[model samples]
Target chain A: MKNILIASTSTIHGSSYLEYILDDLATFFKDTEEILFIPYARPGGIFYDDYTKTAQKAFSKINVRVKGIHTFENPIEAIRNAKGIFTGGGNTFILINMLYKNNLVEVLREVVNNGTHYLGTSAGSNICGLTIRTTNDMPIIYPPSFDALKLVPFNINPHYLDPDINSKHMGETRETRIKEFHNFNTQPVIGLREGSWLHVKNDSILLKGKLSARVFEVEKAPYEVESGTELNGLK
Target chain B: MKNILIASTSTIHGSSYLEYILDDLATFFKDTEEILFIPYARPGGIFYDDYTKTAQKAFSKINVRVKGIHTFENPIEAIRNAKGIFTGGGNTFILINMLYKNNLVEVLREVVNNGTHYLGTSAGSNICGLTIRTTNDMPIIYPPSFDALKLVPFNINPHYLDPDINSKHMGETRETRIKEFHNFNTQPVIGLREGSWLHVKNDSILLKGKLSARVFEVEKAPYEVESGTELNGLK
Candidate 1:
């Protein structure tokens, strides 16, 4: 089976975003020696030895190879050589920038289609959507180029919501932002609130998270939904 | 001379958002009998009465009229005949809904052209843009179509910020969301941080309110901008 781990953070081996998927990751890569790491998403900023070290420590404990893609001068080579890919989150815009700058978006798409195991979180997860319209980051930072990998048909809005923070001072809330998105296009946007993820394996798509995801269809009211459901069915 | 008060709140009567603009509002419409309220931006919500009443009380001392547009069966006539217009804060999507529903978006645009003293706060201020993309609300529940008033070009991302809040549970921050928006569009979006409002009077467009606002341009980096600056120059 193709193994891809698109994680928000690198190590479910310790404190990581995919803690919910640790058992699944371990079970899938039990015989694997190394897991390729794509840190290209954070090309502009300095890595403070924060999550990278954490991911290294966790993967080392499990005898999984942890390779950062930065070492390779060419990003396409790094993606092409990987057995299974693990995408860690930083800035999706930055990630797409590096990917497009090196022209790796197409290669990555092809790799995934070739039945490579794909695992992603946060920024990594965002690339899986049709578009990146739902992201909550500043859109004009010129983080390389704003184009996404286009793995899925809709945009991904990661780290979806915080119920306690008063959205008044911060701007419009998440729900309001997406509704505005809907007004511009007829395509439906899948709003995956935090703690939730969509898992695409083989021909199946599964939804994993605490809260039910919200889906917005143009000219229709937004509604709560779950994963494992087909997006094609809704549109 | 045409008088306009673009505030962050309905009542300079109170609230931190009003402190800087209160005296100016009172002085601008010094001789006006009352301010016409446009609650149409917040259609079908339960908060209109309380919102409209607050402004009524604030202007009550000045004997200013605070009548909601919905009160008149023909809100267009009310707007066309008004001495001044004050748009209160509420869900922008809701407000946009009412604007589209009543076919009053054009009417309001015409009213502005007719030189009616206009005061729009929050949601009201949002409609001033070409598109209300800057609002910090949920995207799920759309009220109506949001074409905005076209008073200005470019989309606005209001109440923008980097993730200062350390809460892990709150999903992705606003920065992440707008970043997603950037990826989808070739046009640069303006990230108007809190305490910032833009004033459009005659040919002069001034960025009012606090310190400096952040500006995001497509395929470029986001930069900090100051008040009294015009948005037209950037586009």
Candidate 2:
């Protein structure tokens, strides 16, 4: 059986890194001893070792050891051998670019499908969908392709923010950017708000956080789905 | 002589499309009677003809007629023979993909180098830089390359918004995004606030409008450059 947790963000307001979701993670990784951490996203350009240490400290509470994928001689072998895998948030382009460079995209997919528990946050979570086109991150680097794991039927727009009516800024809101994506692509998109996540077990995917997620389909109105809602078969 | 106006956005918060810059445009386009409009970045998925009509309505106020480049049977030929050019904003990836698809990148650069007056807003303005890596728009479609016209020395982040102090969102801010870009790319970036623009003529590139732009260089602290500051030789 496949078990995964795809979170919108690693940290929320008034919370330390991964602090809010630590308890949930303890239960999620109860059977696992250690996890291989993919730190290629490097949020704010953090070094891989330092980022891994942060993960190690967080997962310590759950009695799970964390190791950086860069420490291994072969990343593909590492993923296959990992009891659990965690890809933390940063820049999606950088993460996807490194994934393609190391030829780990397929091996990681195969391992996850064969039942290695998986956890993804932010940029990490965005790759669990059909494409990274809906990501809010700036395209700092170009990957070989926009195609992703297709773990879900649609795309995930992580850190999805709602429009602030009182703001003076003129930039396109999150909804506007997604609608523009629908113009050229037919993939449905889920605006996964902060503190929200998708819990995938076997063939079922459920919204597992407190906040409601925004759902968007082509030529239709964008609506909200409450927590605990099933999100499989969105396409 | 490379006469160009690279604006951050088409519309500001209170203005109706192009109202704030009308007087300046009247002077900037004084020598041209007709201008070719590139509507490939169709904001909100608007049709080419309709987007062209919007440009037509705006330019009519300055006594300059607008024509959509799509209407021309030969795009390269139309670019070569144009009196002036205006590339409206929408999605940067869409604009660049279509530009590469039609093989107009070099031709547009050649004509602009030969002194064709050009105006670009948002996505259009983004292409004037070293690359589109700093663009705020979503990557709805993949382009052949992130490379752009290189009309300017650095990248331009249009619709550049400042960090909100009280917001609850956990996504990367514009500055955070640009800092991440600096980690992988060496090119400097200018965050052009809405209603601000860069006026390039011959060898001089000057920031114009009421607001200051944020400048970021690798390994250096980002600083604010006031309006009227020359931006050439920034790399």
Candidate 3:
């Protein structure tokens, strides 16, 4: 059975780093005293060690220890031995690239599927989808492939935003981008807005938090899925 | 001499298709009666023929005819003999993918460099830069490479928008995305707002339109470049 907490964002506006979701994280990662952190996402181009320290500081509040995957002699071995795994968010391109480069994609997926506790935020949550095609981040780096872990049956558009009706910006909205994704893909996409997340346990997935998630399927109108809605059928 | 009109978008907020830039295009492509349109970047998954028809309808108002590159027996020959070239906006990933698939990247760059009258809007304009790394579109498809025409010295962010001061969205802002690009790339980037364009002639490139464009360079503060300012120095 897979136990995962995938969040749209680690922090909300006017909140400290990982503050809003820390309580939930504590509950999801209860039995684990330490988490193996993958800091390759490197938000704002932050150094990996610095990013790890940041995560450590946040986890310390809940009396948990954080260790970076880079600190291990073998990342593959680290994933195999980790009590829990957490991937922070930044640039999805770089994160997925590193996952392939380090040859951890297979092992990471294996451990997560073998019932290891897993947590992903933003770019981290994105890789849990069928593909990274739905990501909103810039292509700052090119990965060998757009394929992800497929931990979830569908793709996730993290930090998804609704169109501003009053704005004059002509760029495609979140909904428009996903519709375009349907042009070349058949997988369903979940527009996971900030403050919302998906709780995946075994074969079941549930939308949690205060907001409703926007669900998009091929040739069908996008509709809202209320909080606590079971998403396994979407898979 | 290179003659190019690179626009941020084909249409403005309330205008008809290409209405805002049609007059400038008419003056820039003064001697040309027909344009070879590259419909590879099919906006909203529109078919090539349908997208070309849209362009034809818009160009007809200016007494010009539009021919899609796909209509030709050989797209390479079509580009080589084109009197004027226009590449419209769409998903940049798919556009670049088709450019590579058709082996048009090198030939297209050569013709445009050899003094062909050229016009690009949004995704089209983005390719005029060093790479498509700065594009805002979803990665609906993967290209063989992120390398582009290098027609200009830097990269371009089409339909560039400023950070919303009042919005609560947690996604990275336009400025932040560009800054992230600088982490892996040294090239400067021009954030071209809607209605703004770059008029490239020979060795000089001038910012043109009603609004100012934002210029971002590595290790320096981003600043606004007024319309009509010569951007050759930026190169």
- Fnat of every candidate, listed in order: 0.19, 0.89, 0.78
Which of 1 and 2 is ahead in DockQ?
2
Candidate 1 lDDT tens digits, B1-235: 3334444444232254454566666766787787788765553444567667777877765567788776788888888888888887766766787788788889888878668888877778777766666565433234445468866556666555667665555444556666655655555566655566666677666777765777777667777778878765766
lDDT of each: 0.64, 0.92, 0.92
Query: Taking the tens digit of each residue's C-alpha lDDT, what string does model 1 give over A89-140?
Result: 7665567767777788899888987877777777788777665555554323
CA deviation > 4 Å runs, candidate 2: A43-46, B43-46
Worst 10 residues of 1 chain A by lDDT: A5-14
Assess chain B of each prediction and give its TM-score.
0.83, 0.98, 0.98
Candidate 2 CA-lDDT value: 0.92
lDDT of 3 at B38: 94
lDDT of 2 by residue, A1-235 (tens): 8888999999999988888899999999999898999999984334998999999999998899999999999988999899999999999999999999899999988888888989999999999998899999999998999888777788999998899889878778889999999888998999999999999899898997899999999999999999999877788
Model 3: per-residue lDDT, tens digit, A1-235?
Answer: 9999989998899988889888888898889999999988874334888999889999999988999998888999999999999999999998999999999999999999999999999999999998999999999888999999999999999998988898888999889999989989999999998999999999899999999999999999999999999999995
Query: Could you tell me how far off, in angstroms, the CA of residue A2 lies in candidate 1 after the best superposition?
Result: 6.8
Candidate 2, pairs of clashing residues: none
Q: Arrange candidates by lDDT, descending.
A: 3, 2, 1
lDDT, model 2, position B101? 93
- Per-model C-alpha RMSD: 8.3, 1.4, 1.5
